[model samples]
Target: MKKLFIFTAILCFSHANNEMEALYLQNGCNGCHGMYGEGMGASPRLQGVREEVLLRRLKDLQKGKTRSAFGTIMVSFAKALDQNQTIEMAKYLSNLETKVDDERYEIEYTPAGDGGS
Candidate 1:
Protein backbone atom coordinates (compact mmCIF):
# COMPACT_ATOMS: atom_id res chain seq x y z
CA MET A 1 0.00 0.00 0.00
CA LYS A 2 2.78 2.39 0.96
CA LYS A 3 4.70 1.71 -2.25
CA LEU A 4 1.55 2.15 -4.27
CA PHE A 5 0.83 5.46 -2.63
CA ILE A 6 4.34 6.72 -3.31
CA PHE A 7 4.16 5.64 -6.92
CA THR A 8 0.80 7.28 -7.35
CA ALA A 9 2.06 10.53 -5.87
CA ILE A 10 5.07 10.55 -8.18
CA LEU A 11 2.90 9.86 -11.19
CA CYS A 12 0.54 12.64 -10.28
CA PHE A 13 3.41 15.10 -9.93
CA SER A 14 4.84 14.12 -13.30
CA HIS A 15 1.45 14.47 -14.93
CA ALA A 16 0.98 17.91 -13.47
CA ASN A 17 4.40 18.97 -14.71
CA ASN A 18 3.60 17.79 -18.22
CA GLU A 19 0.26 19.56 -18.12
CA MET A 20 1.90 22.85 -17.17
CA GLU A 21 4.41 22.56 -20.02
CA ALA A 22 1.65 21.87 -22.50
CA LEU A 23 -0.36 24.78 -21.15
CA TYR A 24 2.62 27.10 -21.57
CA LEU A 25 3.17 26.06 -25.17
CA GLN A 26 -0.49 25.90 -26.17
CA ASN A 27 -1.45 29.29 -24.76
CA GLY A 28 1.74 31.05 -25.85
CA CYS A 29 1.86 32.30 -22.28
CA ASN A 30 5.62 32.17 -22.27
CA GLY A 31 5.83 34.91 -24.87
CA CYS A 32 4.77 37.42 -22.26
CA HIS A 33 4.82 35.48 -18.95
CA GLY A 34 8.41 34.35 -19.64
CA MET A 35 9.86 30.92 -20.41
CA TYR A 36 10.23 30.32 -16.68
CA GLY A 37 7.31 32.48 -15.58
CA GLU A 38 9.74 35.24 -14.64
CA GLY A 39 7.77 37.49 -16.99
CA MET A 40 8.77 39.97 -19.70
CA GLY A 41 7.95 43.36 -21.19
CA ALA A 42 4.94 44.79 -19.37
CA SER A 43 4.03 41.43 -17.81
CA PRO A 44 4.60 40.76 -14.15
CA ARG A 45 6.96 38.05 -12.89
CA LEU A 46 5.01 35.01 -11.71
CA GLN A 47 7.80 33.23 -9.87
CA GLY A 48 7.78 32.90 -6.08
CA VAL A 49 4.24 34.15 -5.77
CA ARG A 50 2.13 32.16 -3.32
CA GLU A 51 -0.20 29.63 -4.89
CA GLU A 52 -3.23 31.13 -3.17
CA VAL A 53 -2.42 34.56 -4.54
CA LEU A 54 -1.75 33.13 -7.97
CA LEU A 55 -5.09 31.35 -8.06
CA ARG A 56 -6.96 34.40 -6.83
CA ARG A 57 -5.36 36.64 -9.41
CA LEU A 58 -5.96 34.09 -12.15
CA LYS A 59 -9.60 33.75 -11.15
CA ASP A 60 -9.97 37.49 -11.01
CA LEU A 61 -8.46 37.90 -14.47
CA GLN A 62 -10.56 35.10 -15.89
CA LYS A 63 -13.71 36.63 -14.45
CA GLY A 64 -12.65 40.08 -15.69
CA LYS A 65 -12.56 41.06 -12.05
CA THR A 66 -9.27 42.81 -12.70
CA ARG A 67 -7.41 44.52 -15.52
CA SER A 68 -3.82 45.18 -16.40
CA ALA A 69 -1.75 48.10 -17.56
CA PHE A 70 -1.65 46.42 -20.96
CA GLY A 71 -5.34 46.78 -21.52
CA THR A 72 -7.28 43.49 -21.50
CA ILE A 73 -4.36 41.24 -22.27
CA MET A 74 -4.37 39.34 -18.97
CA VAL A 75 -8.14 39.12 -18.84
CA SER A 76 -8.22 37.46 -22.21
CA PHE A 77 -5.15 35.36 -21.62
CA ALA A 78 -6.43 34.00 -18.32
CA LYS A 79 -9.82 33.17 -19.75
CA ALA A 80 -8.33 30.21 -21.62
CA LEU A 81 -6.95 28.64 -18.43
CA ASP A 82 -8.94 26.32 -16.20
CA GLN A 83 -8.54 26.02 -12.44
CA ASN A 84 -6.34 22.90 -12.47
CA GLN A 85 -4.17 24.23 -15.28
CA THR A 86 -3.70 27.50 -13.46
CA ILE A 87 -2.65 25.68 -10.28
CA GLU A 88 -0.21 23.52 -12.20
CA MET A 89 1.28 26.57 -13.91
CA ALA A 90 1.68 28.30 -10.60
CA LYS A 91 3.38 25.24 -9.07
CA TYR A 92 5.81 24.91 -11.97
CA LEU A 93 6.74 28.61 -11.91
CA SER A 94 6.98 28.90 -8.16
CA ASN A 95 9.39 25.97 -7.96
CA LEU A 96 11.90 27.67 -10.25
CA GLU A 97 14.78 29.65 -8.74
CA THR A 98 15.09 33.08 -10.35
CA LYS A 99 18.34 34.98 -10.83
CA VAL A 100 18.91 38.47 -9.44
CA ASP A 101 18.94 39.94 -12.93
CA ASP A 102 15.81 38.03 -13.77
CA GLU A 103 14.02 40.02 -11.08
CA ARG A 104 13.61 43.01 -13.40
CA TYR A 105 9.85 42.63 -13.59
CA GLU A 106 7.93 44.35 -10.83
CA ILE A 107 5.03 42.66 -9.08
CA GLU A 108 3.57 45.87 -7.70
CA TYR A 109 0.83 46.86 -10.09
CA THR A 110 -0.96 50.19 -9.94
CA PRO A 111 -4.63 49.82 -10.81
CA ALA A 112 -5.80 52.00 -13.68
CA GLY A 113 -8.18 54.00 -11.53
CA ASP A 114 -5.46 54.97 -9.11
CA GLY A 115 -4.47 58.49 -10.08
CA GLY A 116 -0.73 59.12 -10.03
CA SER A 117 -1.43 62.52 -8.59
Candidate 2:
Protein backbone atom coordinates (compact mmCIF):
# COMPACT_ATOMS: atom_id res chain seq x y z
CA MET A 1 0.00 0.00 0.00
CA LYS A 2 2.84 2.33 0.91
CA LYS A 3 4.60 1.55 -2.34
CA LEU A 4 1.44 2.19 -4.26
CA PHE A 5 0.97 5.55 -2.58
CA ILE A 6 4.54 6.56 -3.31
CA PHE A 7 4.22 5.55 -6.92
CA THR A 8 1.04 7.52 -7.29
CA ALA A 9 2.64 10.57 -5.78
CA ILE A 10 5.60 10.35 -8.10
CA LEU A 11 3.35 9.89 -11.09
CA CYS A 12 1.32 12.91 -10.17
CA PHE A 13 4.41 15.04 -9.87
CA SER A 14 5.75 13.79 -13.19
CA HIS A 15 2.47 14.52 -14.91
CA ALA A 16 2.36 18.03 -13.53
CA ASN A 17 5.88 18.72 -14.67
CA ASN A 18 5.13 17.41 -18.13
CA GLU A 19 2.11 19.67 -18.33
CA MET A 20 4.23 22.63 -17.29
CA GLU A 21 6.78 21.86 -19.93
CA ALA A 22 4.10 21.57 -22.56
CA LEU A 23 2.57 24.92 -21.58
CA TYR A 24 5.99 26.54 -21.59
CA LEU A 25 6.74 25.34 -25.07
CA GLN A 26 3.28 25.80 -26.55
CA ASN A 27 3.05 29.46 -25.58
CA GLY A 28 6.74 30.24 -25.97
CA CYS A 29 6.42 31.76 -22.48
CA ASN A 30 10.13 31.38 -22.00
CA GLY A 31 10.75 34.16 -24.49
CA CYS A 32 9.67 36.72 -21.91
CA HIS A 33 9.38 34.81 -18.64
CA GLY A 34 12.92 33.48 -18.96
CA MET A 35 13.92 29.88 -19.56
CA TYR A 36 13.10 29.09 -15.92
CA GLY A 37 10.50 31.75 -15.25
CA GLU A 38 12.93 34.43 -14.17
CA GLY A 39 11.18 37.43 -15.87
CA MET A 40 11.46 39.61 -18.93
CA GLY A 41 9.92 42.53 -20.78
CA ALA A 42 7.12 44.00 -18.67
CA SER A 43 6.29 40.48 -17.56
CA PRO A 44 7.23 39.86 -13.96
CA ARG A 45 9.06 36.79 -12.74
CA LEU A 46 6.75 34.01 -11.66
CA GLN A 47 8.91 32.36 -9.05
CA GLY A 48 7.53 32.11 -5.53
CA VAL A 49 4.04 33.14 -6.54
CA ARG A 50 1.41 31.20 -4.65
CA GLU A 51 -0.46 28.69 -6.80
CA GLU A 52 -3.96 29.70 -5.69
CA VAL A 53 -3.16 33.36 -6.04
CA LEU A 54 -1.59 32.92 -9.43
CA LEU A 55 -4.55 30.94 -10.65
CA ARG A 56 -6.93 33.66 -9.56
CA ARG A 57 -4.78 36.31 -11.20
CA LEU A 58 -4.81 34.40 -14.44
CA LYS A 59 -8.55 34.12 -14.28
CA ASP A 60 -8.80 37.80 -13.59
CA LEU A 61 -6.61 38.59 -16.54
CA GLN A 62 -8.67 36.37 -18.78
CA LYS A 63 -11.81 38.17 -17.68
CA GLY A 64 -10.19 41.58 -18.05
CA LYS A 65 -10.71 42.30 -14.37
CA THR A 66 -7.05 42.75 -13.60
CA ARG A 67 -4.74 45.15 -15.36
CA SER A 68 -1.22 44.11 -16.23
CA ALA A 69 1.91 45.93 -17.20
CA PHE A 70 2.01 43.97 -20.43
CA GLY A 71 -1.23 45.70 -21.46
CA THR A 72 -4.00 44.15 -23.51
CA ILE A 73 -1.58 41.64 -24.97
CA MET A 74 -1.57 39.84 -21.64
CA VAL A 75 -5.35 39.88 -21.52
CA SER A 76 -5.47 38.02 -24.82
CA PHE A 77 -2.68 35.75 -23.74
CA ALA A 78 -4.35 34.93 -20.46
CA LYS A 79 -7.66 34.35 -22.16
CA ALA A 80 -6.03 31.89 -24.51
CA LEU A 81 -4.54 29.92 -21.61
CA ASP A 82 -6.70 27.21 -20.18
CA GLN A 83 -7.06 26.74 -16.44
CA ASN A 84 -4.81 23.69 -16.44
CA GLN A 85 -2.05 25.61 -18.15
CA THR A 86 -2.26 28.32 -15.52
CA ILE A 87 -2.08 25.78 -12.72
CA GLU A 88 0.82 23.96 -14.30
CA MET A 89 2.79 27.13 -14.86
CA ALA A 90 2.10 28.33 -11.36
CA LYS A 91 3.09 25.02 -9.82
CA TYR A 92 6.27 24.77 -11.85
CA LEU A 93 7.32 28.34 -11.16
CA SER A 94 6.58 28.14 -7.43
CA ASN A 95 8.67 24.99 -7.11
CA LEU A 96 11.66 26.30 -9.02
CA GLU A 97 14.86 27.58 -7.42
CA THR A 98 15.00 31.26 -8.24
CA LYS A 99 18.24 32.63 -9.68
CA VAL A 100 20.27 35.63 -8.48
CA ASP A 101 18.37 37.97 -10.76
CA ASP A 102 15.04 36.69 -9.57
CA GLU A 103 14.49 39.89 -7.63
CA ARG A 104 12.63 41.12 -10.64
CA TYR A 105 9.82 38.79 -9.71
CA GLU A 106 9.82 39.92 -6.11
CA ILE A 107 9.74 43.64 -6.60
CA GLU A 108 6.44 45.43 -6.05
CA TYR A 109 5.29 47.66 -8.86
CA THR A 110 3.02 50.67 -8.84
CA PRO A 111 1.17 52.45 -11.62
CA ALA A 112 3.10 54.86 -13.78
CA GLY A 113 4.07 57.96 -11.77
CA ASP A 114 2.34 56.62 -8.71
CA GLY A 115 5.54 57.19 -6.69
CA GLY A 116 4.88 54.05 -4.75
CA SER A 117 6.74 54.17 -1.48
Candidate 3:
Protein backbone atom coordinates (compact mmCIF):
# COMPACT_ATOMS: atom_id res chain seq x y z
CA MET A 1 0.00 0.00 0.00
CA LYS A 2 2.84 2.38 0.78
CA LYS A 3 4.53 1.57 -2.52
CA LEU A 4 1.29 2.07 -4.37
CA PHE A 5 0.79 5.48 -2.81
CA ILE A 6 4.31 6.53 -3.74
CA PHE A 7 3.78 5.42 -7.31
CA THR A 8 0.52 7.29 -7.51
CA ALA A 9 2.14 10.44 -6.23
CA ILE A 10 4.91 10.20 -8.79
CA LEU A 11 2.40 9.66 -11.56
CA CYS A 12 0.43 12.72 -10.57
CA PHE A 13 3.57 14.81 -10.37
CA SER A 14 4.61 13.69 -13.83
CA HIS A 15 1.24 14.54 -15.32
CA ALA A 16 1.35 17.98 -13.76
CA ASN A 17 4.87 18.53 -15.08
CA ASN A 18 3.81 17.59 -18.60
CA GLU A 19 1.00 20.11 -18.47
CA MET A 20 3.43 22.80 -17.37
CA GLU A 21 5.81 21.97 -20.21
CA ALA A 22 2.95 22.30 -22.64
CA LEU A 23 2.21 25.71 -21.19
CA TYR A 24 5.83 26.71 -21.72
CA LEU A 25 5.70 25.65 -25.35
CA GLN A 26 2.33 27.27 -25.89
CA ASN A 27 3.78 30.54 -24.64
CA GLY A 28 6.59 30.29 -27.24
CA CYS A 29 9.19 30.03 -24.47
CA ASN A 30 10.78 27.08 -26.24
CA GLY A 31 11.94 29.43 -28.96
CA CYS A 32 14.44 31.04 -26.60
CA HIS A 33 14.46 28.97 -23.42
CA GLY A 34 14.88 25.75 -25.44
CA MET A 35 12.71 22.64 -25.31
CA TYR A 36 13.58 22.19 -21.63
CA GLY A 37 14.22 25.72 -20.35
CA GLU A 38 17.94 25.05 -20.81
CA GLY A 39 18.15 28.16 -22.90
CA MET A 40 19.67 28.82 -26.33
CA GLY A 41 21.84 31.45 -27.96
CA ALA A 42 21.65 34.71 -26.07
CA SER A 43 18.90 33.49 -23.79
CA PRO A 44 19.95 32.69 -20.24
CA ARG A 45 19.37 29.26 -18.78
CA LEU A 46 16.77 28.78 -16.03
CA GLN A 47 16.89 25.54 -14.08
CA GLY A 48 17.43 24.17 -10.60
CA VAL A 49 16.25 27.37 -8.97
CA ARG A 50 13.84 27.68 -6.06
CA GLU A 51 10.16 28.20 -6.99
CA GLU A 52 9.77 31.11 -4.59
CA VAL A 53 12.94 32.65 -5.97
CA LEU A 54 11.63 32.41 -9.51
CA LEU A 55 8.26 33.81 -8.52
CA ARG A 56 9.98 36.83 -7.02
CA ARG A 57 12.19 37.20 -10.07
CA LEU A 58 9.27 37.01 -12.47
CA LYS A 59 7.39 39.62 -10.53
CA ASP A 60 10.46 41.80 -10.57
CA LEU A 61 10.85 41.37 -14.31
CA GLN A 62 7.24 42.29 -14.78
CA LYS A 63 8.07 45.55 -13.07
CA GLY A 64 11.02 46.18 -15.43
CA LYS A 65 13.79 44.91 -13.16
CA THR A 66 15.31 42.61 -15.72
CA ARG A 67 19.06 41.95 -15.69
CA SER A 68 19.62 40.77 -19.23
CA ALA A 69 20.23 42.10 -22.68
CA PHE A 70 16.81 40.86 -23.66
CA GLY A 71 15.15 42.35 -20.59
CA THR A 72 13.13 44.78 -22.63
CA ILE A 73 11.81 42.00 -24.83
CA MET A 74 11.23 39.63 -21.94
CA VAL A 75 9.28 42.26 -20.01
CA SER A 76 6.32 41.88 -22.33
CA PHE A 77 6.54 38.10 -22.26
CA ALA A 78 6.72 38.05 -18.48
CA LYS A 79 3.72 40.31 -18.23
CA ALA A 80 1.80 38.03 -20.56
CA LEU A 81 1.54 35.55 -17.73
CA ASP A 82 -0.81 36.08 -14.81
CA GLN A 83 0.20 35.20 -11.24
CA ASN A 84 -1.14 31.64 -11.38
CA GLN A 85 0.65 30.84 -14.61
CA THR A 86 3.78 32.34 -13.17
CA ILE A 87 3.56 30.09 -10.15
CA GLU A 88 3.03 26.97 -12.26
CA MET A 89 5.90 27.75 -14.57
CA ALA A 90 8.20 28.60 -11.69
CA LYS A 91 7.33 25.35 -9.93
CA TYR A 92 8.05 23.27 -12.99
CA LEU A 93 11.30 25.03 -13.72
CA SER A 94 12.59 24.89 -10.16
CA ASN A 95 12.52 21.08 -10.22
CA LEU A 96 14.73 20.62 -13.26
CA GLU A 97 18.42 19.72 -12.85
CA THR A 98 20.47 21.03 -15.72
CA LYS A 99 23.90 20.04 -17.02
CA VAL A 100 24.78 23.71 -16.80
CA ASP A 101 24.95 25.15 -13.32
CA ASP A 102 23.26 28.40 -14.43
CA GLU A 103 25.49 30.54 -12.29
CA ARG A 104 25.22 34.31 -12.39
CA TYR A 105 26.18 37.33 -10.35
CA GLU A 106 23.37 38.68 -8.26
CA ILE A 107 21.76 42.00 -9.07
CA GLU A 108 19.55 43.93 -6.70
CA TYR A 109 16.23 45.29 -7.86
CA THR A 110 14.55 48.26 -6.21
CA PRO A 111 10.79 48.80 -6.30
CA ALA A 112 11.18 52.32 -7.57
CA GLY A 113 10.41 50.91 -11.03
CA ASP A 114 13.48 52.45 -12.61
CA GLY A 115 14.42 49.17 -14.35
CA GLY A 116 17.16 48.61 -11.83
CA SER A 117 18.95 45.25 -11.99
Top candidate on lDDT is: 3
Q: Rate the local accuracy (lDDT) of all candidates.
A: 0.70, 0.69, 0.73
Residues 3-117 of candidate 3 have per-residue lDDT tens digits of 9999999998888876676666566786787656787777767777788888888899889898877677888888998887888888998886543322210111122235554
Lowest summed lDDT across 10 adjacent residues in model 2 is found at: 103-112
User: In terms of TM-score, which candidate is strongest?
Assistant: 1
RMSD of candidate 1 to the truth, in angstroms, is 11.9
RMSD for each of the candidates: 11.9, 11.8, 12.6
> How big is the positional error of residue 39 in model 1, measured in Å on the Cα after superposition?
1.2
lDDT of 2: 0.69
Model 1 clash tally, residue pairs = 0
State candidate 3's TM-score.
Answer: 0.67
lDDT ranking, best first: 3, 1, 2
Question: How big is the positional error of residue 104 in model 3, measured in Å on the Cα after superposition?
Answer: 28
Error of 2 at 3 (Å): 1.9
Better of 1 and 3 by TM-score: 1
Q: What TM-score would each prediction reach against the true structure? A: 0.72, 0.71, 0.67
Query: Model 3, stretches more than 4 Å misplaced?
Result: 1-11, 97-117
Q: Model 1, 27-79: lDDT tens per residue?
A: 67767877667878888888778877887788888878865668377888888
